[model samples]
Target: MDVGLLFDLRNPAQWHRPWADHYARTLELCEEADQRGAGGLWFTEHHLFEDGYLPQPLTFAAAVAARTRRARIGTSVVLPALHNPVDLAEQAALVDLVSGGRLELGLGAGYRLPEYQLFGADFQRRFAGTERNIREILRLWEEKAVTPLPIQDPPPVWGGFYGPRGARIAGRLGIGLLHISHAMFGHYREGLAEGGHDPRSARVSDLLPIILAEDPEAAWHRVAPHLAHQVNSYRQGSVEGTGRSTPLLTAEDLRDPNAQDTRGLLDILTPEDAAVRIRELTKDLPVRHLIFWASIAGMPDDLVTENIRLVTEKLPPLLR
Candidate 1:
């Protein structure tokens, strides 16, 4: 499995650091991860959050491309519901050229309604809109009029899927599939076959939240607040919209330091244990890449750096 790092670039109000520090620190971390042999650096997209979640991931990805020669720079999921596909294609092509063709674009119809509202995108037509956007992007890449052609011929594009329908669209479009959970791998593969494509040739990837430490207990305590905040942020944002299933630990449960049942919420493991879990994944899922989100809910720079280091150094050897 190709291991990568995901950065949300959230400036949580409670973190108590200078707002600009996160961006600078992310650049430094990305460069180091590249030098240390990380396969990719993925950035997340969100808009109008209180603590300034990254809205322009492609822009940040451009900076990452300039600083890192090896790591594939990408957006975990760029919301096409809020963008002009032609403009997005232009920007992505530029980043691809800068990164020497190392770009993996993950497009999605985002779940949050407020973001759609803020960007003047129609929530009801998001899936259709995303499909149209992808079509236009692919068309633009092939047409000769498009300038600054991407070094990657038809640069790798992955469609983010929340369910089977999304997976079907990805397969029909002949793009990669980006899933969040291992449980959805079957759905994605089925979609690929449904689209009259060979399931084995279609690329599949996932976003996994993980934390590593010498002591699992200490790591769990350290990441619990951030994990809770990350989960709660989505829950709170979905109040007026369609909400997903509730986890064992609600935002309130995690807020209480004494809460005991936060076990399955995230993977809190020592480096050795983390490697074992990752190895087990290859047996069941058709995952070409595994992207880990180490910097969660404004985790401290030092802790985030160490987690990245541990995963980058330890996980690959075990997989091999």
Candidate 2:
């Protein structure tokens, strides 16, 4: 499995830093990971976020391309229905060129209603819209719609469909799925067959948010608050037309053990244990790349750097 890192580039109000400092620190970390032989550096997208969640991942990805010589720069999921497909094609081609052809584009129909509404996208037809966007993107690359074309003829496109029906749609599109769970596994294979593509052609990847640290308890203490903030931020949706930015939860809120939002995703493991859990997660699937959060909601620079080191060095050996 190719191990990678995922970043949302969120700088929350409580832990805010100058935007330039935040970006610089994150890029430096990416360079460190790349030098250590990380398989990829992936970014996530969201618009109008209160914590200033990354609005344009492709833009950030272009920066990563310039800083890293090895890691594959990609977006975990870009909501293409919100923009013109040709524009996306050009932007992706530019990044691919800058990165020397290391770009994996993952497209998804985002769930937040306001994002779709704000972009004037047809929310109801989002599922179909995503597929159409994928088709147009592929066609544009295939037809050389841009000058000189992308370095890779049709860089791999992935569908970030975490639902049963959507999994089949990804399969029918003959692309990859950002699937880390088994819930939609069978459906994707069936869809691939239905699309007259071999089921073996199905590629899978995902982001599992956990930390690998020497002292699990201490690491958990530091990351729990950030993790809670990350999860609870998604829950406190706005009634008005603005994006979610309020009612941020502290680590204390998540300590209840019954704090509905935790969903048991918080864990800080010894690298040894993480290797076993990861093995179990992928044993039954054809997992091409396995991703983990680089840092959860910007925990701490020193700690985040260490986690990246452990992941790129210690963790890979254990897996081997």
lDDT of each: 0.81, 0.86
Superposed by TM-score, candidate 2 places the C-alpha of residue 314 at a distance from the truth, in angstroms, of 0.8
lDDT of 1 by residue, 1-104 (tens): 58899888887888856866878988898999999999889987888777688889999999999999988887889988789987898999999999999999
RMSD to truth, every model? 3.2, 2.3
> Would you list the clashing residue pairs of candidate 1?
none
Q: Model 2, residue 4: what's the lDDT?
A: 91
Q: Which stretches of candidate 1 lie over 4 Å from their true place?
A: 180-183, 240-264
Summing lDDT over every window of 10 consecutive residues in candidate 2, give the lowest-scoring window. 237-246
Best by TM-score: 2
lDDT of 2: 0.86
TM-score of each: 0.90, 0.93
Ten residues in sequence with the least summed lDDT for candidate 1 = 240-249
For model 2, residues 120-239, the per-residue Cα lDDT tens digits are 998789988988988899898888876757888888888898899889988998999888777788999999999888998978998886788889888888888788887777766433
